[model samples]
Target: MADRATMERIWEAHTAGEFVAQDVEATMDDDPIVVHVPTAMGGSGYDGVKDFYARWFIGRNPDDFTVRSISRTVGDDSLVDEMIVSFTHDIEVPWVLPGLAPTGQQVRIPVIAVVDFRGPRVRSERIYWDQTAVLARRRSC
Candidate 1:
């Protein structure tokens, strides 16, 4: 089991845009699973699963981002959350979908993340969100 404080810190850090998430291991059958869904990035795992926010999502100063609200459901060693993510895309980067160029723009999308813990570290995780929503809002340079 993980301490509530530690879990809270992890959530806070994630919301704060400090993207050095340690041991954010994820799996298909994991408690906190980002069920297979098609988005701008395609399907599961880190690279193609959840869209990056810090330096990868927008490709600019990540400090401009914020996580509005986080609702958590705690378990023995697992935590699941629904997050409201808000951010401004101000740079150019690769798209999770193949062969798509960067479209610098600002976007906000709601997402859900499930995380399992091994002590104070995450053992596995899964995240779900809408990539189409993000892509639809992109602005051409």
Candidate 2:
């Protein structure tokens, strides 16, 4: 059973700076799925997730990127999180910015994530953020 601490540990592992694909895999179920809703950048299943993490998400964050949790709701086998993700766009972040080049501008986006677990490991995650807000911020910057 996944408790609040278990879910927090999973979240920490996912966002940790020096983690490899296998490190992430250890925190997930056999057939996990992840979706970054605005960009459709995440992957499904084992191989696909490994590839996505290795190529896009893991170690892809900019030097100043950070995630600040606004609120978190935990259940027996699920967790819901509200956060503000901020970064200076100084490098390619395909998972967040997709095909856009680095704008060298500061950006902050509010994000919400729904995570489901199975047998103390994550089964899936659906992450949401305001795309229009990001575009407007980038346009003004």
> Model 2, 1-141: lDDT tens per residue?
767897788877765532334358767778989889998888899888778888888888887877889999888888899999899999988887877789999889899999898867789989999887787777677
lDDT per residue (tens digit) for residues 3-85 in model 1: 87786676555434333342233222222223323333323445433444322343333445556556888877778888786
Model 1 TM-score is 0.57
Worst 10 residues of 2 by lDDT: 14-23
The lDDT, on a scale of 0 to 1, for candidate 2 is 0.82
Candidate 1 runs further than 4 Å off: 14-17, 20-63, 93-104, 139-141
Error of 2 at 120 (Å): 1.4
Report lDDT per candidate.
0.51, 0.82
lDDT score of residue 92 within candidate 2: 84
Return the lDDT, model 2, position 55: 88
User: Deviation in angstroms for 11 in model 2?
Assistant: 2.6
